[model samples]
Target: MDISMGDEPRRLTSCWLYWIAVPTGDQAGVMATLGLTQPTPVTFAEAETIIDEDGHGEAEGNPDGLSRVYVSPEVDGWTLVIGWWCDPCDGERDDEVLRRVTELSARYGRAQAYYYGAQGDGSAWLIAERGAVLRRYCATGEAEDDLFTLGEPLPLERARRNELGLSSSWGKAVGNDEGGSEWKSAAFHLAPKIAAALGISPLALTAETRVRGTGVLALTPQGAEAEPVT
Candidate 1:
């Protein structure tokens, strides 16, 4: 059965979520590259349920609290790996997450990860190419500096800034008039658009989306080698 995209493109969920999109339909290769194992076939809806229900739950296999990702096959030449543990905004794990995403890009040529938290109204995105991260941005909708930023602003980001009458250059003062939670909130909404522009956005998946093969549930590396309890 095919799932409808509906009007869910802008909202990840009621809380938080993270997903990685790569430009390839090689499901097996993607799982292997991510060090994921124990694949279980599942429908797109079931996959979403698994991720949503177990995203923050502790499981026997995941003793380290790593993410158990749902690996979608090919959706318009891109595969999405959904799991909360893949979050890029985690301060402590941000570096490791970026490293893994960069490595994934190295193998696949291009990869992107997105994070959104409804509670804080935070959104983040990272785009990597050939093992190097080209751009990364985060906004928490708080009265603080940008959480994290790197490389140059993406064309969409530049255009957005221009539309909002903000500075095109990063770190450049855009005056208090143009600086407020509006821009940060805008970032939250922009994450999905960026995903749509670059590849497939999880929220954009629908019956109309080109899907090849089925999704699979896989254990993260932390749980891949765990021994079953006696």
Candidate 2:
């Protein structure tokens, strides 16, 4: 069953997953870029159902790590890749995730990844263009040293820093003990908003969204095997 949005609009939350957006309608390119194997055609509705079921560990034959994903067709000039494989909460896998996102941006001119965790425990976002990640931020509410962050903060993040009375330079503020804690706390909820401003928020997909083709379910390289959960 579809999760209820209540009076508020649908927002990407829980079932912790990563969303990758690229400005193109080429679903094949997206699938190939992610190295996804075993293409299986599915409509948007079916894709959503699969994702929901997998999130609940109730999907038929759902693997331990759900090495499967839903790739949406072009919607309003953007294509979205949804999966848990790219989640940024793992400090050990941070470089690997960034490498994948950079590869996508290198091929598509620009790519963005966003993560929203269950119960607001963590959140992250990365924006890359022309083979370079311009900004990356992650706050997993884990060890302080494990807070993976890189590049400069985006404009929206800068504005938020100002609102929080942080220094103009994000690096400098993060260098401060107090500022770092405050920013991390605030960043825990910034993924969804940053995603909306930079490209598309997962929940922003609506009946009004311009859709060019159907979504599809694809397998990761390991097929039904599990990827380590952070």
Candidate 3:
């Protein structure tokens, strides 16, 4: 079935079968923009996945705990990265989510795995080329029988995301009608390990760290630099 954003036209839900994309810049900001809460790392493994880019802090690795399988696919000159929180089919919903990512992962050439993060749910987000989205799904939003929700502008700008090698917008549905899965709540739910490793919760740890976790994609050549993916 097709989900409509009023008169904006219909979008396929097939994108759901794929994965969600979170920007590396503003994780919490994007969650709030979408009415979702920030997510904290759940298991010890999760804590390890979170990396600090600024190098202001560091975290110890978690040898125990559940970590989902990971896969990085390349499609249509883009990298499609996917990870599962757990396996669902084996009743390990989290691993299953990761399995889906591996299954959905594309081979080299077009779309490749760029970046991936573990999701609270049994799923993770994959970052791929904009072109991959077009080819992966029919231009008409038909071929894969998929639909997407073109929601409001994320906290981050498209120009910024370009610098991050991600798209400007993450325009699929990741929330309930009431925006149930707020990243803020997610952040609180997580162990300090995950949050610390990913450099998340900077808003709390630092005395005056800005909460600028906007998950926008960088589209310009400049965006593709070590700059924001606006």
Which candidate's lDDT is highest?
Answer: 1
Candidates by lDDT, descending order = 1, 2, 3
In model 3, the runs with Cα more than 4 Å from the true position are: 1-18, 43-230
**lDDT, model 2:** 0.71
TM-score of each: 0.82, 0.83, 0.19
**Candidate 2 clashing pairs?**
none
lDDT of candidate 2 over 1-230, digit per residue (tens): 12222211123333666778888998898888878877776766566666666656665555444477777767778888777666654566668778888998999899988887657666788889999989877667665533566787688887987999977574523334458878877777888888788788777777667666766788877654554221
How many clashes in each candidate? Answer: 0, 0, 71
Q: Is candidate 2 or candidate 3 better by lDDT?
A: 2
lDDT of 3 at 39: 35
Candidate lDDT scores, in order, read 0.72, 0.71, 0.24
Candidate 2 Cα misplacement greater than 4 A, ranges: 1-13, 144-147, 170-176, 179-181, 224-230
Which clashing pairs does model 1 show? none
After superposition, which runs of candidate 1 have C-alpha atoms over 4 Å from their true positions? 1-14, 55-65, 118-120, 142-147, 172-178, 225-230
Q: Candidate 1's C-alpha lDDT?
A: 0.72
TM-score of 3: 0.19
